[model samples]
Target chain A: MDTATKPQQIRLSTTPSRADLEALKIGDIVYLDGLIYTAREGVYKKVIEEGADLPLDLPAESAVNFHCSPAATVNPDGSFNMGAVTATASFRFSKWIGPWIERSGARIIIGKGGMTSKDYREHFVPNGAVYLTTVGYGTGALLGRGIKQVKAVHWNKELGLAQAMWVIEAANMGPFIVDGDLAGNSLFERENARIAANLDKVYEGTRPAVLRRFGETDDRTDEVIG
Target chain B: MIAIETIQETAERLMEKAAIEIPEDYLDGLRTMANTEDGDLSSFVLQAMLENYEAAKQDRRAMCGDTGCPRWYVKMGNEARIEGGPIALEAALRRATAKSTNEIPLRPNRVHPLWRTDHDNNVGIGAPEIEYGFEPDGEWIDLVTVHKGGLFGTDYRMLFPSDGVEGIKRFFLDSLVAFGKRGLACQPAIIGIGLGGSKDTCMVLGKRAACLRTVGSRNSDARIAAMEDEFKALGNSIGMGAMGFVGKSMVVDCNIEVGYCHTGGMQMSVHAFCLSSRRAVARIHGDGRVEYRTDPDWFTDYQRRESVEWTPPQSLSKSA
Candidate 1:
């Protein structure tokens, strides 16, 4: 219901005491203000699993990391020529959200494609963190517009520009939908159930109809998963 | 003979164009869909997508950041010889890709698998995936440059010949549903279904079909064309509206391309392109005359459905 309503603007930052992420409900569109760290698939493994010290200094608390491998070219000095920087698909990194939150004190993980239940309910619920979904394609570029400047970068040579970590100050940095919230709600899970129920009605007894149309008899049973 | 420099130059131009240019059909389709979609948010989202397109065009930036994998589909003429033969085309393409990396300022997407590696210019072993087809008795080279988003990477499977058309349809519908579940691919997605071929061949057709066919194009085979029509409605009905919002048109079209396969087995691959489907088409004559076209002409041979009334299924969100 909140998703269908107007979004509120909230500025979250490194100071965990300043804002209550838990107060944010699922589906509330929030304009994230201030510094948001950019990391991707490999950064989690490096920091959480592999125990590689964070290559760059980060906020100690209430930190937000976007799951993006930005297409940027860092200049010879340090400034980045921001190319089309978009969010990488979030499903693969869903497994790491919980650990990253635990290890890094990150209160928000911004990405595309809401995370699955494994992380959303199991880890995020207890951790007081949330997964925010943004437009996977264009908005990432738009977010680049809000980035006042790139403060620092890490592992540029090893991960290249895309996978590298860039600490950027983003002002009004998002029109992000709260797909997974600290309230134990998941927009994807809700949508999935509705669609599955509809599929049942649309294709009820589809196998038999298919067999008849193809002029084939059921000879064997084999498992098929989409 | 077509000079290698001409091929290289043409490839460079195509890569640059494909990154920044939204094909005419796609531009038209987005405007139409933006206007047709039911809600204000959906329309607003589509408008933002269009604005992003305009921003990319004016700023000379990539339409969407994904920039995807750099892929070129070449239809080489049998009679049109190259300066260093057909093998030289790959070299030309590679050179073009490097140049375009700086000019288009493409994202360096190519990375190492096992160890840490960055190709720096979006070039590595097997990068800039080039697939070729031979066209007999022609004097020109036709090239289609497509930039695919990372979301709908590629999915392929081998089904028994006994699986029948229904099985293929089920597989496609099921995949479409799963792909849209999280709205990662970015709807009004374009899907290409390739049926009946070896695994690799099916993937090639699937990618080409996904990239080349304009939204609303149909297959030549009546049965296949019907399948496409069914998919278009079924996909929209899933209620995965634009950017996973609540609206009807999740996908603009489903293009089906089929090829003959071994008697006992059928291989199918499904490839998807996101809403910002970026592609360009170009042709070079042996005499060095170059012509660029907006359409990929992939469906030139397919028999298109004349008129089909679309009846979208109930939106899943409405019931929710």
Candidate 2:
């Protein structure tokens, strides 16, 4: 690796401004500060589908929403024990992301395995939000250390620990890579294109399976996720 | 007789170790990849993972928040006896699983598939699957716990003998490319390939090959071992690295396991044990001695025996 080309790292607020996001390139490393909250399918379904009011102020409280399920537990005394924090795949949440961003006024969506550029163009670019991916698909323990405190957990009884909304105070919490940018450019798609250029040569001697499955694509450029 | 209390205690410790510690084999493998990896972003991700493991151990936290599904692989010597028997042994394992989930602060990942019920503990119906195997001699039981990330980077296919190894290679490449994009499979992982076996067993064999086997280990058969080397190289040549970046560190190692399947079918499954690659092992002797190690040392000669009638190896017979 070229040391000269080392990714530039920056720190930004959880409630980042439009300029803060616009200056971010697709591969810049980002560390976050201020408040962030966890929400996934359960929280999305609750607020967007079931028509329940959000338990807290949206972008006013925290513009960042983490697609995460921490290795956490609530003690008998009711305090939270958050050990490791990592993101789930963001592509799975495409259905509700646009609506959630619209409703919450989020500027940053952080998770693993970023959504497609189409997703970025449709949901995020219009909403003035960007996608940041957790490095290594995670650096859970490191991320855990960045969490200054667990401020609150909502709907633990109703949605369960993995699905509940967790409000947290963060201090330089990251190692996240900017996967989506203001222009809706995707780092992953760029990498995929580069990788796809060689698939033909690499796959030379092999033949497809004798049996075929429904909806399987032979196109190497296509993504498994929508 | 092996005490059930000892089994429970040992299991709990194994759980913590699996969650927090990066086994030496996997660590060494990753270090090698790190040294060779040249893609800037991919290299950075590898470096971050190296530090993550250290932080996990130093702070006594799980390496990955998605701690994967906790499972048990118990192997007993034919002569081994438990104080309270198999039923008691299972209860002990389950108790340890639930207790350690809370103690280690593991994400309670298991839930009811259909209704989406969460126990808040990893324990649920058939959650931490316990599989069994036996050796011909001795009075000791080996307990292995593997916390394998359950999603992505695994696939199965049915092919006929006519399709041959070429077909196998195609499926292998397809799986790697599909899941390797954006690092969904959590690449530069140990790739396990299972060829032959009934469909379900193919999946099991591939998973065990990924989770149970250590890096650099190869199949016992000479031909299969050769294929393992070829597959590892083939996967790396795909020009993808950690996080699906442009690089050549895709596969740390490839392990292939095979079983007899129906003559008409060649069932294949591919599994990738992610960057965390969490597995821990311990053996408990009847007289109360315990030893712990990272390598499960699964797939012994006896486990892969090809004959209908079992025969003790000459060395084993002489020792007996």
Candidate 3:
């Protein structure tokens, strides 16, 4: 918590500290005070789906990437809660949280759920970025802290909360684990990469789940998984 | 003389009045929690509810547009009499539907999945309730037309890394996981379960469950009441908060509708929102008349320079 002697710089370097990362354990709490970028389904996919580059210039350095699409709320106690759900559907559109974390000059990937990608690790280790986990269903609690403000840019009204860059300021948030880490020996990264390497084999070229019940479409199940 | 009530009249009445909002008791409880929850994240989740209330009021939009599949449940009074209903309730309702659709612009959400999408209409097979009977109670025929909307991202079966609950609890956890993966769009989402009913009935109720309700409200059944409490607490433990980011994200509300099950008919649906969720309901007399509430306050306006954001501009701790 040193403030003046050697203030923690919101580093923008492509590489993070390996020593700082390996020193961490599974449940070790961290208060990351730095530059982080938030994006959800629409913004995440438009990067590749639309074959576009990073929305505002990519900063794959010490930046952090948060995968979330928050709704606005005002608590009775006068606090604010934002980002109260899961980012899986956005994941359905694009699994860019990891890649963007790397490309956005971020060394931190934060959100609920798990990510399994080798490229993510390859990038994470050299850059010293790590994946952190927030509780799976505690979304409402996350937002209850009362949002001070969500500094958002590059918004898509049509996409609503789906595609946008949000700067979230959290309060008293804790215990979000490092699901994936830059130690290069993380469990999350290894499995994700293995899956990605053979996604085409496992899912690609597969027929669409046309005969789904409730008379729904299988447009997503058959999409080209990245 | 068939003095037809112009469809326009019916719609305005419905929008302005008939749509049934969740019971007062439900919202009041949520207000209490939003005010009292000591948990920081708990307060944030509650705030989302406040926003919903404001949005539905000011804009006059369906509080949550999954305004649901409109199911007309009719209860006739013992002395209930028909004036000129030679105009089928279904037809009258259809006319009202068309008017409501245009006015609220409730996204042309309905489409026959089996065929090409056509929302040029609102009535479909067995829609607006062609099925009904006399209650013989003269109970003033309180017509409960409930609208349930789509609240899912993936099927419960589609929840990956199979979880560890069994029986109803398994069902509940599966719902949470499915809700996380599919129900919620990675945002603050309310999960409502239809405990028992026909495939159609449960689905309708399930949608309504998320329509609008005060948090902490419960069913009369002891089992369900307990289940609601457990599901909510357990869900929060999952740390899927507002936008499913992470925190003590509270499920603002979860409603369960139960009816006699008919052959493998149990359904659960989750209507998730990144925040600006809009859903509301009202009631009308058999005459299609209603006494709607006066204009209330509007929701927090969407600033041109602002929108829903998962992360903040500064560390939330700045104020903490």
In terms of lDDT, the best-performing candidate is 2
**Candidate of highest DockQ:** 2
Off by over 4 Å in 1: A1-23, A55-57, A60-62, A76-78, A136-138, A208-226, B39-45, B151-153, B160-162, B299-320
Given the true complex, what DockQ would model 2 score?
Answer: 0.87
TM-score of chain A of each: 0.80, 0.97, 0.57
Model 3, residue B171: displacement in angstroms? Answer: 1.2
Candidate order by TM-score, decreasing, is 2, 1, 3
Clashing pairs in 2: none
Instruction: Summarize candidate 1's per-residue lDDT along B26-59 as a digit string, tens digits.
Output: 7776677777776434455676677777777777
Query: Please, what is the whole-model Cα lDDT of each candidate in the order they appear?
Result: 0.70, 0.93, 0.43
lDDT of 3 by residue, B25-74 (tens): 44564565456444333343355456644544544434442344555544
lDDT of 1 at B243: 57
For each candidate in turn, the TM-score is 0.85, 0.98, 0.48
Off by over 4 Å in 2: B316-320
Taking the candidates in order, what DockQ does each have? 0.30, 0.87, 0.04
